[model samples]
Target: MDLETLLSFEWGIMMPEFIILGVATVMTLLDLFMPKGLKRKILGWIGFAGILAAIVSLIGLLDYPVTTILFDTFRLDSFAKAFKLILLVGAALVMLLAISYEPKEGLTEYRSEFFYLFLTALLGAMIVTSSGDLITLYVGLELLSLSSYILAGLRKENRRSNEAAMKYVVNGSISTAITLFGVSYVYGLTGTTNIAAMREILLALNDSQSVYLLVISFLMIFVGLSFKIAAAPFHMWAPDVYEGAPTPVTAFLSVVSKIAGFVLLVRVMLSIFANAVTDGPNSTSILLTMEDTIAFIAGVTMVVGNVVALQQKNMKRLFAYSSIAHAGYILVAIASLSLFMFDSLWFYLIAYLFMNLGAFAIIQTLTEKSDSEDSSHFSGLYTRAPILAVAMAVMILSLAGIPGTAGFIGKLNIITGALVREQANYVLVSVMIATTVISYVFYFGIMVQMFFRKAKVKDPIKIPVGTGIVIGVCAVATVLLGIFPNIAFDFLQAQFYEFGDFLR
Candidate 1:
């Protein structure tokens, strides 16, 4: 903690965080002091550039050895660096969507706030990925959560937006308190806030009471953090929030925010809980004992998400349910505890990011044009805008896990992960397969609206420049990743090498 020691720590590895912080700060000042009549659309472009810059800086750190600073509160490692790239890329696309977004009410006031708020949120997500201590992770989580709550309600004139904000904050506060309570228990038992130290200390613990406390702490933290990923039991907030929030923000929550939650879960469970040995003749990790709990939650989430989605006529609500189901799929990978856990997660997230965001872009375009959220609004899209319809179809195909798409490949990896596990897990795999089939009912309904139904209007849908770029990039990436997944796997393996540095 001494000034000399602090100054001696190599700081170059943190360039990405520093860049994001600096950009958000400067943008905040610009938003306040600028002329009232000056258009703020340029601020979105500025934020996009800043994200790209941060990505470049993050890539620079890939070759560097794992480094810890601020008393091991911040870490620069392969895991952090790899996931940070996804965050930066995903956030950058979101900024583009915001720039292209045209609200029905003509969003004029607080235009600049929208851009910078997302930047700050992106900053928080980056911090969460790199955090090495419990306190640091929670701070990062709160920063992201608070920003999102405001972003959800940014449409001050819309009553739905306001309501969404209220519900989000209330739910978020409860979850935060629960997660912190669990963290307190861990710190009380291990007498350290650092995750590395907690792991080492927990490994030495074999008493029944201590092991029981570890189980309680894991469950408390698991339930608390499940809110972040929109998993079942904590997922009631997602449909309403997604329905009311801006389209770009909805996509960000479903992808970027959800991924960050998983990172937090992995950081905690795989660290301390993986080491706690239960008392008695046969030693078992605490995490293994909780596998059924995780699997059960995952199964319920998939069924609830897919089954409810069938009844939703609103596009956003359907996607919200879709988001919930996807979270369940990821959790199945985690509970399996297979050797491919990290690979499955990374590939699946990448696949979801492209397909989900692209789908949202099309949904926003179609809904804004029709001024309706009903799935019927997409009727006969192909007749009016052939290219846009095809793009949307690609996204949907990937989302439904159709063959020869990225989603299918991702799901294959996940199912394979379950099958290859050391112990029994056939029941969870069966649940996943059944839920995926049920999801097709709604997923293909959109396709029906797009390709088979008659047009509600004859006019061609106009695609914005920014939105066009996002759709094209996401669609192409989705198809390419599906066809040649090894390209992505090579990068992950080359950079991370099984995430070994995570514990060391």
Candidate 2:
């Protein structure tokens, strides 16, 4: 393969990154120089508008037959387009929530910067979905990770904010370093960094020792990637970071960051495992070994995340654990890769985004009213803010995988896909069912506090229009998807499975 040929584009791939970065840079400039008043609001609008424009561009242009860009370092297809749309839409909603929550969090001074970082992080995640080479994937992941570290500490004066930032930076650096070392291992084993070329080399190997090189290198890379998604054992940093981060930042971390990490994992595993699996008895492929590893990881992460969450009293920390548990559900989808690689994961993520972020938006708004993050403040919330209580109830129901909500659809798809892979694997099936039951205890625990408990104080909580709009949209999306999941599911299936046909 000629290096020059590998460096290739159509207009479709460049526009998304270009428009997002332009808006982010302009917002950064405005944040640096604009006076502390109404002018800053304009910057926020501009950044939001820019993301809106990019979303339009993506929806308009993302369906043009799969194409390769920058010499195949990036690829454009329905799969990439679908994830980009989800990230952009989520970014837009988070921006509005940030506008409403920033003042309450004492982050009003840096509103423009906040939006700017959000856009940049969105751009990075979009890049992660599009990336087709190791180098491109690394660049996108780091861009997303660095922006998030600062966003985690957006409240500079808060000690927890600084501590979270410090921990994030320290651990992030170590993870990235470990990931780079694994990348080096893959490069050494394959003698190339291009995924397709490396897969070809691994497939050509004829002995177990040679193929073990393939499995070990991939596992090493998965370590760093898994940490980004907050899968258990590597998830120590997430609870404190989510609790300390500004609420919108926490929402972004939980949603956008997880999406990017999953995209990378799906791409890598599919490319490598699919090739090895198809090569037959002559090849020393480790696809089954890899799947077993992923399955075990998925089960443990689901059980541990939910069990730990059951003991948390703080809203953010509770949801932080919930996010980890959700990652396990996502892993179930990924583990079903042998049956269908992308459809179930994409469907689950779209729903997960609305359900999880909607929950966070309500938590942020409630914090504003009570001026607290403790879960106790939610006691008798139905009397104080019935609308929010109802919205939170819907989100919590969805998260708990209750029927008639988006979370239910997401969980249904995952388990159904898992069954497709191994209907008789009672262990995998039983664990998924049991862990989900464990999750509901905590999810409903919050709702019970809101609806069933009597108010300890007489004051009513006021919900801001901006915050309400954010949570309302998410609640509507959750309910809409539940009643008619085909809305997002059709698009996701078409983009991944139907579009996957184009690749073959």
**TM, every model:** 0.98, 0.93
Report the number of the highest-TM-score candidate: 1
In the order shown, what is each candidate's alpha-carbon RMSD? Answer: 1.0, 2.7
Query: Where is model 2 more than 4 Å wrong at Cα?
Result: 1-8, 37-39, 103-105, 277-284, 369-371, 422-424, 493-504
For candidate 1, write residues 1-504 as lDDT tens digits. 688997998899889988988888888898889899999988888888988999888888888888998888899887888788888899988899999998897679988989999988888888899999998898899899999999999989988888888989999999989988888888999999999988899888889898888888999999999988999989999998998888898988999999899988987888778888899999899999899999999999999999999999999999999999999999999999998888998899999999999999988887764445899888999889989889999999999999878999999999999999778599999999999999999999999999999998887678899999999999999999989999999999887764858787
Decoy 1 TM-score against native: 0.98
- Residue-level lDDT of model 2, residues 1-504, one tens digit each, is 676554533655668788999888877876777666754667767877898899888877755677776666777777688778888888888887777775444666666677788887888888888877888888998899999998999888888889999988988887788778777866876787777677777666645565566666668777877888999878889999998888889999999888888887777666655565323455434655577788888898899899999999999999999999989888877776645546667778888899888888888876754345899888998898888889988998888889999888878877777777644345766788899999878888888899899978767666667677788899999999999988776666554546463233
**Candidate 1's error at 361, in angstroms?**
0.6
List candidate 1 segments past 4 Å from native.
369-371
lDDT of 2 at 420: 71
